[model samples]
Target: MALIKCSECGKEISDTVESCVHCGCPLGKVIFNTGNSWIGVFGKYIITDESGNVLAKLKENQQFEMNIVEDTTFYVQCNTSIRRNKVKVCVPAGEINKFLVKLGFLGIVTVVSKID
Candidate 1:
């Protein structure tokens, strides 16, 4: 088997494993999308894990995909100097999970799994 780096804990692991033994982060992929909008033009949005570890920084109209545990609930927050928005998401195994992040009225951040 090939060795790969665990996306969550950055430890070397066998690619055949179902989960990262080091941090329990599963090998499933999830997508996070930040659509292009005027509200996001000013600053970057920070995405972090439940333990407050930063995963990615997204700008307007950007998309990021990462590994996550299947059928588990995780939290992510959008942080800025004036406002913060936290979102909880759960993705089932063997299915595609896509989330959209947006800035709402009065600089409030919102994240939704469905477009409609």
Candidate 2:
């Protein structure tokens, strides 16, 4: 169960709990997203390396083109399950020259350029 802050006292309380322990305030009703998976048909998990946590949940069938602010790794679900197994893919920066040099592929380019 996730912990949410109480609106009145600003105290942290369990989302599964019914009330706040600090101020004895009622948390009203709470709902946990016990869907088939985090990556349900109606939502997608958008992860970012900037924060080691969930950024936000996208709406279902929402179509909007957004430029990635930075390098991000999205864990998309391939199937529905409570375990939430996913595949991770990394997005690299547009500066490919440094990456090629790091991977030792720059030598190949130099050799080919000399032949040409």
lDDT of 1 at 49: 68
* Cα lDDT of model 1 by residue, 1-116, tens digit: 67877767889987667788898776765777878744444566667766777778888788877654345455655565255667777666434567787766666665555443
lDDT of 2 by residue, 23-71 (tens): 8665543111212222335434333233446544433333212222134
Model 1 TM-score, 2 decimals: 0.62
By summed lDDT, the worst window of 10 consecutive residues in model 2 runs over 107-116
TM-score of each: 0.62, 0.29
RMSD to the true structure for each prediction, in A, is: 6.3, 17.8
Candidate 1 Cα misplacement greater than 4 A, ranges: 1-27, 40-42
lDDT at 42, model 1: 55
What lDDT score belongs to each candidate, Candidate 1 first? 0.66, 0.35
